[model samples]
Target: MKRRTLLRATGGAVLGGSVGLAGCLDQFSDSESGDTDSHDFPADYETETFDGQTVPFAPLEDVAEWWENDEARFVDARTQVQYDEAHIEGAVFSPSPDGLESADPVAEWDTDTRIVTYCVCPIAQAGQRAATLLDNGYTDVYGLADGFNPWRENGYPVESNDGQASLSTYEIEGETDPADAGEYALAVHPETGQREASRIDADGGYELSLHFVDVPDSSLLELRTPSYELEGTIEEFSSATVQV
Candidate 1:
């Protein structure tokens, strides 16, 4: 949807005071500063509203500079399986859009911190969480524009937060691992340590996927190919066989 809301600053001299308001996100406490000055902040704040939440959304190219900064925190809004399969560097799994809005994960963060939320989609569930922060009085909130795809495409680091997921390769609640034998078949990625959930076999080629479900609803999946990582919503075991 085309956003019509104008993210203007009223309580301050200007909406955005400076280019480096990012520092304010890192160092200033939400209580330390009220919504008094929009100066030193991203100028004329504008955000794309998703799911009734207005998050600071910016293009991948625009916020690329933030990747190297230490003050930024990237939150993965996708499911645990997806996160275990792939995710951006320094990202934490909050699953805010999935109904964890008032959860402790967000509580761990100070209201004054600058958090960049993301998800798997053309748009993101993080938009809602970003808006939540703003509504709670957070001055700085941003949603990574292209979501996780841009980060991976840009060659940034990705990892599986498998530890945070409820399921693991060691124990398949339902479907059996069709990739390898024994423990290796149903095990975490040796390198990423993410649990392997599903595999793909197509025309003599095969791939694997680790679906993350605990993530916020603002995310989607980017299967690597004939292989996939499908998120299972039910407790019963589900299975699918693809012919190679």
Candidate 2:
């Protein structure tokens, strides 16, 4: 049997200028922001009609029950790093955007398998992922109504790499030196060969606070810009950092 690999974001196109520094940092928040409140689902949340099919939202309790019974598959619709830092136990990593096309882990699941997609966003990414799965012939797909935050808040089971309960933050400070550096990606590499990247703000000075699962001190970090790419291990980064 061929082992499946999670899809990775590649090229400058993956960064796409849509996410800003602040928005990226917000993913590590312990609680959901105000924007999430409006989209929170009640116990009596209504199902929506999509593509002539009635799609339902899976309440947190329902998801918890299914998880406890191992009756449903949980898909994380955030970035791989986010998934690694902390995720519901047994949930699969399937980041949004390129994930549906590149990192589709459920491509071989039975059509009747109960699948639940969840994200920290305002019901946008998770809902889209669930809809896409439904469009692709999945019979029983549902989006987690309030996503992982609420589940975590309710003292549910979550697993983290490196034994940390939450993601570890690292402040990456460097100088691109070149004034014309437009945009760049800072990638964190764990020993397991998974790469998590975020767009770095290039204006003024170059500084970004990155989050990661338990990255061993021996893991590698890379900085990629339009003109150049530099790679080094975390040990070197701690002392010298990435200097372009």
Best prediction by TM-score:
2
lDDT for 166 (candidate 2): 48
Worst 10-residue lDDT window, candidate 2: 29-38
TM-scores of the candidates in the order shown: 0.47, 0.49
lDDT for model 2: 0.56
Q: Write candidate 2's Cα lDDT for 1-244 as tens digits.
A: 2121223323434333222112322222221222222233454753543222344577788889999999999888766667767788988876643254554788768988898887652444465466566766777788777567788879999987535434555666665534323343445463544333332343413444545556654566665444345666655555554554
Over the stretch 1-244, how does candidate 1's per-residue lDDT look in tens digits? 3111222212222201110001111111111123323213455544554333445565566556676767667776654556565677777776644325456476677867777777643332455456556676766668776566667777877766455554221122222223311111121232322232222111222223233344322222211111222332212122333221
RMSD of each: 18.2, 10.5
Residue ranges of candidate 1 with Cα displaced over 4 Å: 1-46, 51-53, 98-103, 162-244
Q: Total backbone clashes of model 2?
A: 0
Tell me the deviation in Å of residue 56 in model 1: 1.8
